[model samples]
Target: MVSMSKDTPRLDPAAIVTSAMRIADAEGLTAITIRRLAQEHGVTPMALYRHFRDKDDLLDALAARLLADIRLPAPTTAPWDEQIRAVLAACLAVLRPHPAVAGLVPARILLSEPGLTLVERTLALLDEAGFAPDQATEIGSQALCSLVTLVATEPGAATENTDPDTRDDVIRAKRAALRALAPQRYPHILAAADALTLCADRDNYYDLGIEFAVAGIRGIRPATRTSG
Candidate 1:
């Protein structure tokens, strides 16, 4: 592959984010550095500074791009619970494909237009379901946070590619470790050892969490307003 050099044309902010994402996906977030990006884009490190104030700024831009990739469902007559599930699923779908970027999400500001738009729509859904403004904000924030946590912590979700034998060995090792725990001291854990180490059926696991969140939201009844 031809390497970018200093003689190439100036790199735009979008190009910088794109290159950074590519590096992050191929290697890992740790591989993303201003100097590294500059080298990849055929520009001086100082040129990147012109586009981003610092690494944090560049990461925030990357987060924005990732959020922008989610395609929220259009307004529909679906139940509020279904609406909430749809939004969460859309966000997860985008994050799952770019696990490196997903890990940075908790630290990155979601003030970009696409991010705010998502927040706005989620709150609107809650409001329509009879939740007060404050309640909507709290519940919406918690739901989104829970979804991010799920994606970030999913087993092997962010791991770099590994050959089948190596991957199987890792899984076997984990299962063996879990099984070795004393049943007398950890009865529940011992009983669920197989489920704990199994990485298959992640979609079902994710759906279960979403269902739990939706059920919790439904259980919250809006406060009754009082007037003099």
Candidate 2:
């Protein structure tokens, strides 16, 4: 099949993965299958198998392609916080762009060159920001994984289902169910029901998280240095 590469007019793997991602995003991951991908491309199933051995191979390929698009910007000369913010923002944009893959991201084990590049870039950013190697790895892991978790749990396209009204109703209902609890045992929660029911603006929440993380890192750095 690879020998056919020149004459067969190779289908762009990146394009195939983009289309597949759209399907997964719209219909859920289970809807992604070799038959479906072939149909989407107007190609024979045999052609797809030539490109990817199976669904797992396709998934791995898709992840690597997605990561490739997110090459980290150089952090040279920028304040550490801004650099960190850039990384987080870039990562969020990349993951959010492929909502289907957002759910699968946390489970991904780096198996391709692009994936390795991403890991290296992340660690490099943390190291630049003055974190010890171990600390950098830990922080990078938590931040990147959290971005996937956030996007997967609250995908932009699925906002209607997770709207504030629906969320508040569920929370209130849960609070009401706890009515049987002795007031003394849960006094604070019971008293703060109204405050707890208040909804925070989603954009602000995202910004706040980024801000908090950057601030925490800055606080930990030495007073004489502002290089991070």
Model number with the top TM-score: 1
lDDT of 2 by residue, 1-228 (tens): 123333555677777788888787667778889887776666677888888899988888767766777757775787667878887777777776576676555456377776677778777777776677777777777777777766665522444336688765776675576554679999887775544444246566466666766676667753343446
Each candidate: what lDDT? 0.80, 0.69
Every model's TM-score: 0.86, 0.68
Clashing pairs in 1: none
lDDT of 2: 0.69
Candidate 1, residue 84: lDDT:
87
**Worst 10 contiguous positions by lDDT, candidate 2:** 1-10
lDDT of 1 by residue, 1-228 (tens): 334466677678998899889888778788989988877777678878888999988889989998889899988999988998888888888887676688666455356888888888998999888987788888987887777777767775533356778867877787789889888898898787767766478888788878888889999998664445
Model 2 per-residue lDDT at 136: 74
Clash tally, candidates in order = 0, 1
